[model samples]
Target: MVTLIIATIPACELALSDVFASLPDIEIEAERIVKGEENAAMPLLWVRGVEPDDFEAACEADPTIDDLELLADFDEELLYRMQWFDRIGLLFQMLTNANATILEAVGESETWHLRLLYPSREHLSKTKTFCSEHGLSFSIDAIRNMDRDPSGRYGLTSIQYNALITAVDAGYFDVPREVTLDELAAEMNLSHQALSECLRRGTHVLIEDTVLIGAAEFNL
Candidate 1:
């Protein structure tokens, strides 16, 4: 059975550690990371609680971050395409060796919370062992089998699933758009950006699971 692994690692142990330290109050969330060759990938980052000038300057000064380009600028958030050139072993292992899918990756202050989906329990163990041998400080917080988890089967966390469901029920997807993200987030008691991320990730998972080969796996 497929397994979902919840783990935590200090930002210093992962990529962009300096950026996190420089912007201690900033919240960084990965949005659909694209894996590329030569241990480099451009990840869409949703950075919150910092001005564009400060964030860019910090990234420029950080040796780990290679490049950054602004994608969007919200009231209190900025989206950017970022490339980290060093300290990405854990991320590379999760994506390549473990063959895991990153469902959610959020970084705050000094710690990073990761949600990964592996093909089997053994795969997760191997990944864990690799981390231990390399002294990456990767710590497992929880594990769940897809068959046993209500929302795991669809490759989404409980919170992501709930956000998607609530949005649908509130007609957030109606033809004319009955509800805005802010209103829906207020109703759900989640921040505007939080709800937006949940909805985006949840919808992506839903499409990948139901519209793609995922439907064939379950015969829906």
Candidate 2:
């Protein structure tokens, strides 16, 4: 059975770590690959917690980013069409691998997390070898057979699951709100924006599985 692997890579090992470090307050989610070819891709990004102007300025100053164009703006988030000019070989290598499929990728501050589907353990082993040869730090966060987790019944990704559980235990969701996002993030060793994204996505998954799925089953 194909395995779903969730892994984290240090931003320092990636080409865009500096760009992410520069905008420490912003959260970036890869929405989709708008276009892709060998060694290059144009991805639509969802950015939050930064002003549009500030994001533009930061991009202009960051050497890793070739260009960024605002596609849409919302009160709390912005969509960007970004072009990465160089140093994308790692991603290209992953994409070109015949045994894996990249499902989700999000970056915040000093780490990039990716969810990938690998055809077998041998494929994953080869990927790890590839990363090691390239001096990239790769750590697997979770792994499950894709056939067994079609509905994500095990909950959110490991990081998100743990974050949400810790937050709840710490009273983050309580009416009085005992824990601040920053405090919780500190406990998890994650940036505030990253923690926020984790909580948001975790809650969404919980609701979808428990409430939405339940409602649909009964024709509610």
Candidate 3:
């Protein structure tokens, strides 16, 4: 069966990393490819991040960036449409060459984290080899089989797995709720809101995988 893999690619090997290095104070929260392949010109990207004015200036001055336009503005982050001149072709090659599907990608301070689905382990091996051959730094952070998990059903992401296990161990789901949300959040070293969101999403996945799916199978 196909496996789900979460990988991290160092900023040093990515074109966006150069942009981020130039604007060290700015952080990118999310990114989406708006149009065209990664290698093509005028590839539109929708980006959300802090310091809109600085971001604009940095992109304009950066050699890697071809052009940029402001799409929207908000209190926390601004949205941008950007075009890249070069240095992104390798990423497209990595995905297409491996025949992998990207589930999600997020950029942080030093790296671009990606969740991908590969046909099999052999395909993943080939992709890693391709990266090494091309001087791209690729590291697999986590992997799980979609067909089976320790819970005996749908696989949970590393974060979701940890959140659910921690909640149970800390007695967050106890009859009287042995642990407060704040206490649980502190124990996990996460903000209360973040912890709550993780648990909510984890519980939803667990229920869907174990209870809902099982019930449906039994009926059929």
Candidate 4:
């Protein structure tokens, strides 16, 4: 189970729900197996290209924009290599191949951050060195060092699940806005106490299915 989180925490959190929902919902028959347990291995590696100006233009352009294909292709290659190790988790990289053909088109000059998830530290380390040797000048941000909250159980009862969906729809629990529990309950037309238990359960499912297993299946 591995996932990569780039961007700020709040932005990452918002992106999580959106990203997970985009994945097909069909269930797989595999059981959850904790890999690299007790080894304190980091599962993610972030790589960012130095061409800041070009990276921003790529982000703003449509995904189908022809000019951005090269940068997108490079990112796909990184993802491909990571998956080859069976240790690859998630990847987010910044590059210089987008619609900003002119320098003036680059606004605010945003930096790109990519988070790559690997199955083990060994795999991550090897990939890191590979990038550095290639003159990529990328940095590594290990997952083990990040503060991942021990998520409480979420996704239990159907009512609770609905409440979570309601919150998500309203963007209530969004960390950026800090949706209050009371407010979420009201929005769901349920009592706050009842909603709280449901939220706890729903969160657990989200963490397990989306955060852990989602990254494990990439570019496959």
Candidate 5:
């Protein structure tokens, strides 16, 4: 079955991290990936809170960027098309080795929060193993079988959706805590561990899709 994963990778490990490290206030997203000669991966980027000239200066001094061009200007936001050097092999492996697709990527606070889709659970495992070998941390916040909607109705699985509703209706989210975790687990006919997973995964999905700052899906 196809799977959807929400994960985090440290920005320090990404090729463009050094380039944008100077612009800590800027928000960056991988808008889309366009194939170039020799099947090079070039990404159209949307960056906010930085002027194009400043961004240009940063890229010029960064060794990871092979080339860059400004594609549009929206006053506060600028669109850029850029190509990375061979340093971005990790990204290529995620895309081709496991046949995964990047749905979203947001850079902030020394981390890249990503939404990724894979053809199967095995593929995701392959990615994890690959990262382990490379000493790259692939931290998964939530994952589910993308059996119905790929985005999962605002990025939640059916189980997560139900879990949230059950928690809310049972007053699990109340300030005073109307229900205990164990009680909630019993109410849901799930083990305590299972209930914990549901709540944690569901909450992560809800926040990522709704309230996550500067989060956006990559344009396919």
Candidate 6:
């Protein structure tokens, strides 16, 4: 599920055959695809390209690529068959690996938008085609800003606090069913290690402030 973006001219009719021809070793298998706005000159592309390098050189040659660019060198294969829980875990990784400017929305199936500073039509076409073949949809919308303030009162780190707030905002924490730490971590876009630390610190504070204070308040 590694994503590599390449910017090309023209909004439609991407000559993918030429792009695939460049990387013959890595099979250009189709997967979930998506594209940018229909009217835009160049759209964003996300594809499961071949191993090692996908289109870094093309990005370099094309100055239209944005600073929060998707590098085509990393590996993201396990994402294909991951279960719902595993998918959540990977989602956290995706958020972490993504640039700080990553934009997220919860209105419909958790949409993420990375503002495209540089546009590429060829890459967008191929990636959209690939996603279509794999039954994934793509959209082009403005990136939304997170509502949580970073300098909050909690001891939780900025990301941890943001994650908790995001979950609370999304109503994930309000679910009645049992919530796994892994799942929470995944939902928060944090590693298990970080998630565990936050919980530990939170539990300690609760015991000191709430649990202890409650005994005195209620005479329990």
Best by TM-score: 5
**Cα lDDT listed for each candidate:** 0.79, 0.71, 0.65, 0.34, 0.76, 0.35
Query: Compared with the true structure, what per-residue lDDT tens digits does model 4 show for residues 1-220?
Result: 2223222112111112221122222111111112232321112212133233443343333221121222223341211011111111222211111111110000011222233344444545554555455444333322332223332122134464567677788777677866777887776677888888777756765664345432221210
What lDDT score goes with residue 11 in model 5?
A: 70
Best by lDDT: 1
Clashes of each: 0, 0, 0, 13, 0, 7
lDDT (10s digit) by residue, model 2, range 64-100: 5666788899979999887764666666666666367
Sorting all predicted structures by lDDT, with the top scorer first, yields 1, 5, 2, 3, 6, 4
- The predicted structure with the larger TM-score, 1 or 3, is 1
Residues 130-202, model 5: lDDT tens digits: 8889898888876666556443645666677788888899999999999999999998899999989988977
- Residue runs of model 4 more than 4 Å from their true location after superposition: 1-157, 175-179, 214-220
The better-scoring model by TM-score among 2 and 5 is: 5
* Model 1 misplaced regions, further than 4 Å: 148-220
Give lDDT: candidate 3, residue 143: 67
Clashing pairs in 6: 1-76, 7-120, 8-120, 8-121, 32-131, 33-131, 64-118
lDDT of 5: 0.76
Candidate 6 achieves a global lDDT of 0.35
Better of 3 and 4 by TM-score: 3
